[model samples]
Target chain A: MMSELHINLSESLKSKPASDALGFGKYFSDHMFIMDYSSEDGWHDARIIPYGPISLDPSAMVLHYGQEVFEGMKAYRTPLGEIAMFRPDMNLKRLNNSCERISIPQVDTEFVLEAIAQLVRIDQEWIPDGEENALYIRPFIIATEAALGVRASKQYMLMVILSPVGAYYPEGIHPVSIYVEEQYVRAVRGGTGEAKTSGNYASGIKAQEIAKTKGFSQVLWLDGKQHKYIEEVGSMNVFFKVNGEILTPALTGSILQGVTRDSVITLLREWGYTVVERVISIEELFEASRQGLLEEAFGTGTAAVISPIGSLSWGDKNTEISGGVTGELSQRLYDSITGIQRGKLADPFNWVYTVK
Target chain B: MMSELHINLSESLKSKPASDALGFGKYFSDHMFIMDYSSEDGWHDARIIPYGPISLDPSAMVLHYGQEVFEGMKAYRTPLGEIAMFRPDMNLKRLNNSCERISIPQVDTEFVLEAIAQLVRIDQEWIPDGEENALYIRPFIIATEAALGVRASKQYMLMVILSPVGAYYPEGIHPVSIYVEEQYVRAVRGGTGEAKTSGNYASGIKAQEIAKTKGFSQVLWLDGKQHKYIEEVGSMNVFFKVNGEILTPALTGSILQGVTRDSVITLLREWGYTVVERVISIEELFEASRQGLLEEAFGTGTAAVISPIGSLSWGDKNTEISGGVTGELSQRLYDSITGIQRGKLADPFNWVYTVK
Candidate 1:
């Protein structure tokens, strides 16, 4: 197996202690995993380099065309003082899917997992031990060719950078109010909505800023076709509890297939909950809220785990949901997921992969 | 006015005699104008730097989130060997509009013009002599902050890169085929379609590739809502000649307000053509094609002065336009615009501004 391939480590390494005040994505760990792919070279030259700036041509496609994709996952320092990642294989698969959609070469999943494991093992000292602190791993690929034409780049760079992240919510978790944006749509069918690409997130910044100005945590994106269906929250996959059943928007072509979103669905189903992935229109959500049938609503993602929605306001109309607090099911799901991540609870699905 | 900035020419700056091979955005010149903007200091340290690699943080927002905008214009070498720009103020105004939409700070229009003038004057040797070749200026702004969080960046870099571009068609202007993309939608209402952001072009790269694979020059993008209304053709604004009337899609908040589009409208109006900016649905276009009322269709942008559409393929249907050649009106409009730009005809509208 090529698993024993020598990893040329960068000489210029800057190591940081675990007790340092953790920020979101500012400071990086000493080493980063990199793998380059070309039409002839395929995938080769896998190495661990010091975290630093990347030199790019002024006409690199990523700078002008924004041809890039990224994945966000975390390596947790378990109660046993061992590093564990939650379903990293899912992230690898999803990253390949995104690459395929963008015409980028796909890396072998085994190679990616092994490389990530090696890097995390080397930087295990950077993973924090607190309740919410972990090593945030960002695996991203960018088109690196020095061409100005509007075509697929010949060369690409895939690198993984690790950042020590504190809790997404520094204080105790509180339900957040979201603004229902009727004006801006995040993704449309037959677009790059399903892919975790830079363009998708870049297009939503204006709407997100608008939502923040209107006293909301995030903007609930609607269907691009008619702006009627509840597509997703900007950075998270949305879930709704109606009639004592869990409901989420189906994996339509316009919505990202988030790994956390899928995990929640699987766990809820395994735990004896009616988890249905179907088109949940905004009208249905509002109507259910009016009838008190909507028990809870929350967004799920890697960042916040499960961020409960306290209320939703759209165009001067406001609706309170589930006593404006974390719902019973949401709390339970959060506990179960976090427990599995921290290696406190039994991972029945074998979702946690230990980094060796 | 701080117009006399330091010009640190790069060692790679070799004097290549201006050739007709300047094609669009290729073959950049020696020097580029650059200025930095920070939250503390609004905008300062304006200088002409050597065009070279830009070192960027791996997590820079522009590479990932695509917080970038750009403007495209050309400086023509007049018969008197003097450089002139066509409707530069319009480009500046449109750039500010793009900046406002993308949350980037707008620079002083006069200051930007002065900077461009200085750069053009310094690099006058790179400007081509023939009417077919001109110096294309690309003024772009990118978020340079090394943060990964989704927020407005406090630091930005604005630079104007100069490229000696040849004619769109060096041999001769030929009509091209375009594929009508019924599945993919480029922009929707209240989206960043009107703004010249990198995300907008990034989203179209996949569709462009598909169109190219199907033997088409570009993909005709449809509105995101219904996928019925014609929005644009690649990076250019589209126009249709239906029943002796020039029709273009109205600025419906989702289509780029192309400066070249506006100039064409004025030029056509002056030449006694009924130019109407209204919703031109795809159904009407197909119907007109069937009735032989569709005389010609063309795309307008800074890159290609006017690209004639010879044929359009939608789904399994194919329609020939104007006998697969540039139509009378298309040639007339092209001639008038190029004539005015190259100082071969009367400048009645005072559109050309000489850069002294």
Candidate 2:
């Protein structure tokens, strides 16, 4: 746990991308944080090195078996030109939970946090200077053991990379259309739906692509057990304001516990808005929309803090939500979170952690 | 597809392991088969190269999204010193089917077959001579693009590796005890369960590990939607001889279409055994077992052609089948399949394909 951290600067650093050209996950910083783990060494040799390729045996377990987990956070540049992060502790804890679910070894959260902060400070220039533009940090652990077996790996590698990303919505807070997926499922209640493992993501992409083809931005997955209960929309936790009460699917071990979703719930509760976490079936939601009770719908995730849902198409039935625009609640939640992240608003919740 | 294949022999070929010490997936051949695929060039540069590591960027799609598929087959040494493969064509076609499900580009089946055959012919000496010993061939494809978007990857790599493996049952062909998994669901209808994708395997492994802790050799999974219908046993297709009639769970999109299971059904049908595929619920199975109609049970997969199920433990209920010994049908199926694989019996269905 007390491994000495090493930094090896790149001989020739690459130039950062122009702020306007940055989209998401495309341009990376010069340096990355990495660590290795084995049964004997137990997570040793923490280092920050020049970003480059990682060679693995073709028979590595991560490639053959999807034994990998990742976390996404961002470093925001405040109005005073200082770097800040939002509830990184929550992300780190969730990462460990994901590792436990998939049998990956748990890492020291404090040490990993320190390493991440150090890495971000080293490449602070990559933090793009634009509203909503932040240096997106991706921390991932992969099973690096060189074996073809379908079991847990004896060796693992943790690497954290930084990318300068544009706003999730390029123009502004526009609404996203969603397709209710009935054919394919993301996860069941007793599956890796709650875990941030690669398998869950990989298995769910086909449905997302199908939605894209159907002119929708994301796929709203139903429960695997019955294809009735609303599980999630793409990689985000879904929410709806039916009869003026915010309702989201409960954490039933089949959906990712989104940090932003929790924050939204907290803020809504504080604002005297009724919030409920219970199983909401697709039938009930559509019927509510038909009766004009479904006031507003949205999705919450770390990547896109609040993605307002404009429409949901299930089979031949299509319903418009929030008048195909960002709802008032979606707007407020986004503003408050982004404001605190950029040091524009009062940090009463103490969610922001300044690195510089 | 007409690209000339490159051959790079190892500087010093590794020594072969002793027959008895050849564990599963432990010792690999000196060379491996590989091919590259990109959006511009669809699956080109087929080659046989020295077994080595594959360097990937930390942001490779396969690391984040489990966009990977694999196939398992074995090469057997005939009594006349000729090497043979069991239904390589079917395995290749199934690999394409899995690729289709995972959004991976399909490779030319004949070209890949030729590549695999060439590699096996080159490493023919590694094929063990023991009755149950053969070279286990693993063909896998993985997403190689270095991006973090949750869409299909533009770049992919396909590699094939061979390992000299001893018998799955090192001691003898014995019956296995299984724990019926009702807590964790593996797959549901309209999921990747039918495809040989890494996510399906990775998500299902936690249950397998739990069963291992309970001293069961494997996990018999029920359907994901309802924890009632019998689905599969570990990585194999399950079958029960109920009242002298062979029955297996139909391919209802959640159960893997095991290659060995199909062969077993074909052989049984040819031998005048009434083989039926339908939905079999756990309650029905238990009732049949109680009434002694479930005389024998077994699992079928490429690794263990026929793994007889001696006992099934579900919750507090445990029942023993076939007096805890290999059933007559199970023993005959194993003997018939292995005999044909080892070139000891006459090839009636023409499954044995000798490498040129």
Candidate 3:
């Protein structure tokens, strides 16, 4: 049985930003979902309260040890004037996986899902009505134990905050340039790379800043050991269409199992396309580009859904894929996935969850 | 030149605990040093304030991205009633190195040192008078921008908190058993292993937890790429003496450059011992143990100064080092370092910094 959820609504609401002016994660809704966890109490005091600053001890373990995990999902306003979520259960499950790796106690996924749904319902008007705009939900757990010891924290706080975001590609679907990072590695096997944790993102900031200076938007990471095989594109799982086959790097304990990546694979397989998951080296990819066999490449994630890769630069070599345009496959995947999410297309896979 | 520091003393201070009852990092002092940073003004607002909880926005990047770095040091009460710090300048310099890697802004070391001196001066009474008790200082910088973007935050908080800690070994310095961790990697060559960042420690907790369950006090980490070469012992740097030669892993971009490890190396070299810094494999160590050539091993860090290793368990093989007793070299080094730190021995190398 699900425990009771206490509600404390805010008396005053902040003015919402214009849908067109809403950038990514810039503004938060009026209310947020919060739950407390302790070794003795397990998890309790689930509630929705006014969004505000939190008071933490100076010696909180998360500030010193980085023992935290988070998940990202979106709540869309469907044409039927109802809110929809795309496979939020998968995100909660993945959050638990991250918690296990970070040594945090897990939460009941079903109960948390209900809490998220309730939060979205209370802040339903905050969902943007723009073409690609939606309410971005961020669920995170942080170690709150006020101790300086180097161990798992005894207390934690799990919170969910909502932000209405504008379109990833504000103008249109434009492919982005990617610099293949050689100096730094995102993660190695037996590391926290596969989890939706902050450390992985923190370490990638330097590489990302370097790529930005080089006029590229993101970096294509190679495997940590060999620095040969492709691991990921920025924070997204990468996919390539070579010769008529769809290929992506397998989940080898170093890259995130992206929810959109999984959905794309399922849709492709349902459409009679042969999809293969295995290690693909950068050299082979460049060789394919040289031979005109690399047709198109893109990254998959919840934020962008489908982000086309325009070009890749490794060492002294640069190759533009699909004439530096969004490929047919990339566009089709984006449209189909977004359509299903927004209730425009038939939900063949039953991937949409509606919030009452 | 240093900026003028503002000070706010607490009206009333809390009662102090008995020296013998003080455990490691269990109790904090009265005052703390804090400095704020913004892209617009750099690091400013340096002050000593009453130690208390800090208010942070729910979307502070540090809580979500783990963009933070920290340093650990101790202040000891000398036999002559003077407070002395061992190589504090080194800790401040290393903190800058960690800041650069984590993309946080650097603080003026001299200015920060003055701030620390002031805070320590205000809380000098909190430093315990027990045999092995002293004040432990933790200096950390955390991303404080209330934005949820993936990049580095535009604002940060650099603070130093003091904790009165007891001796690492309460009764005496006894050797500990270690398990060779082969499953989880602490860090890779291109990751944040060398930096004093929270992510490295966060990733190491699971392996340490596993080792503890098997009757080991710590886990000896191996290199990430091959998982064969030695890296670190728990959070400390490892050193081994075999066949009259000292061996420790080189500063190979994947292991922390420990201050204690450096001082020990200098001491050994000055005493006419040949210290080799190179990649030593676990296989070679096991082979030496089989041939009865392995003499002794220990881990070095600020907390313990010197932690002697009694035995090592690798897979199904367990070998006792120096008959599971503290080696003469380990004990001597501990005595020399702690003696110098406490102003009990001659400061030939001029390592101790006395806070006036």
Candidate 4:
């Protein structure tokens, strides 16, 4: 079902030279990819048109009911100046998982990958050639049907938009301070937490804001039930190092199975590190930190390959992780991931997908 | 601060016959009220424009990140043929509370109410004169800024759109079957469960669909922690009658404080019924049903004022309530609330806010 995509290239490309100087998701390329889905027509009318406004009915299900899911990846510029996407298949799988959870129709992963590859290929010039810069790719599906009823939509729109992003950390990879949110939760068991959907992110905004106000970069959300177990951060999967062993939250239904998080875990195991996935209780983590067993903490996501945690503030206690700097393990994980992405390291798992 | 609103009404209106109707959130009136807010301009560019497409940047926060909140109310036609809105001030206050939680800028409640009134007054003819028919009002705010970073949006849009709706149960108030969703939780403590936001509703779609497929009208969500306590039904606040006492989930931070839910509580208390807002454990409810202490169960929302629960299926256990018919308390509460809204009974509580 490889239909010819209607390509409406912009009359002229507008260059954003300073985009590399800005942070991620602050700038866009000239064009975007869009495809419409209806129960009657399936997925049809694919197009790559000028990046502009999308007119949606005010009562569109996405607006009122939040029937939407999205994927986040990047188009990386290698040292050879060739543009590629890292593990797009994973994003496609996650996107479908999110769609299934949200009751949206499952899109063919092959179709989505082909569309995305073509999109990045056409917008190749937008891929920033820098250590920390790339073209951030956001593919989202929204319910466009103009009905306010609390039911699945019959019509939907799947779109892929490119943003020319600078470094995720404009000031370089400095360890961040994270606030332990004891009140607000990001996801619960049997919620859309495992899916790359918008609801989970939306729910975390308040807690994230509170974290920011308290002088933290992001929130460390606990499980919704007892608020005692560790879950994840706002947009990333969390990992902690206890006694030189790496532990992350298991896929217990409430945490997003991030592509970066998965890749990091694989690379860690490949490097002979003890990577464990299980329910990490907050009480255990706090005790471990106090006992000097908790060595490091970091979060993994597409935007930030691995963001090191400098310190954690939960309740009234603020504890520094590995002397409030990036630990050796955190640095190694970041280096391996970025090195592979930047073509500095050998691609052992064949994770990089060239945009051609 | 009342800035002059730019009321740009649509030149033409699309009129639909009174008999042609959908349940809710389907057909829209000709015009809509919109206002734009930016960090620079504050809140400006308020207008009543033709109901049409809203152009948004591909990287708009709401599209990808789900930084959105909304409120639902209705405009009714009194016997004097005057269009009136229910307690809109309550909606406005709740909207602001949601905005504050999500870090979105707050709109003036008076401004919002006046704008809603203006829109409803302009679309007064669209309000169906039949019983239980009115113009459903959906006021929503979305983060319109075209940035993908995990931060609050600097720009926002506050808009009110009206849709002409028929009775939710056009075939009369038939008892609805509800499935006990022990696996999928709608919200958790410390989440946006209480806010009238898009993410909270989006997370419930899958659960609702599963219930629907299982021959139920809605899914009764459990508390995210233990999945033991009954929280709410899809989109509506839930209620239970056990041993002649009306019981509901307290404001435990995971359930929406529905206006209809609050109104029902008030009406029940004034009607000399024992009402309690506390955690209602699912096990207790099931045990009560077994012991013949559970008398009735229902859901309350603006769309479905009060829908009787015929039966509940949790895991392998199936329980029927009130012989699969409307219970006496359900009938009395429904009659009192609907009677007040439909101008059939005395509203001593002054719950109705008459539109000027």
> iRMS of every model, one decimal?
1.5, 1.1, 0.7, 1.1
**Is model 2 an incorrect, acceptable, medium or high docking prediction?**
medium
Q: What would the per-residue lDDT of candidate 3 be over residues B177-252, giving only the tens digit for each residue?
A: 9999998999999999999999998898899898989899999999999999999999999999999899999999
User: Residue B129 lDDT in model 2?
Assistant: 68
Superposition TM-score, candidate 1 onto the true structure: 0.96
- How does chain A of candidate 1 score by TM-score against the true chain A? 0.96
Compose the digit string of candidate 2's lDDT tens values, residues A229-312.
999988999899989899999999999999898888988998999999999999999999999999899888888888899999
Name the runs in model 1 displaced over 4 angstroms: A1-20, B169-172
Model 4 residue pairs with clashes: A183-B190, A184-B190, A185-B190, A225-B225
RMSD of each: 1.9, 1.3, 1.0, 1.7
| Model 4: how far residue B44 lies from native, Å | 1.6
Candidate number of the best TM-score: 3
For each of the candidates, give the backbone clash count: 3, 0, 0, 4
lDDT tens digits by residue: candidate 4, B1-356: 33577777778879675644566677888899999999999988888888998888778889877889999898888786666677788888999999987789988889878878888887788887777687889999999998888778999999999888887766556678889988787888778888888888888888888777888888898888888888888788999999989999999888888899989898888878899999989889999999998899999988888899999998899899999989888888777887777667777888777877
Q: List the residue pairs that clash in candidate 1.
A: B22-B165, B22-B166, B23-B166
Candidate 3: where are CA atoms >4 Å away?
A1-3, A169-172, B1-3, B169-172
Query: For candidate 4, what is the DockQ?
Result: 0.81
| Positional deviation of residue B236's Cα in model 4 after best superposition, in angstroms | 1.4
Selected candidate, larger lDDT, 1 vs 3: 3
Model 2: CA > 4 A from native? A1-3, B1-3
Residues B83-106, model 1: lDDT tens digits: 889899999999899888888888
DockQ of each: 0.65, 0.78, 0.86, 0.81
Error of 4 at B61 (Å): 0.7
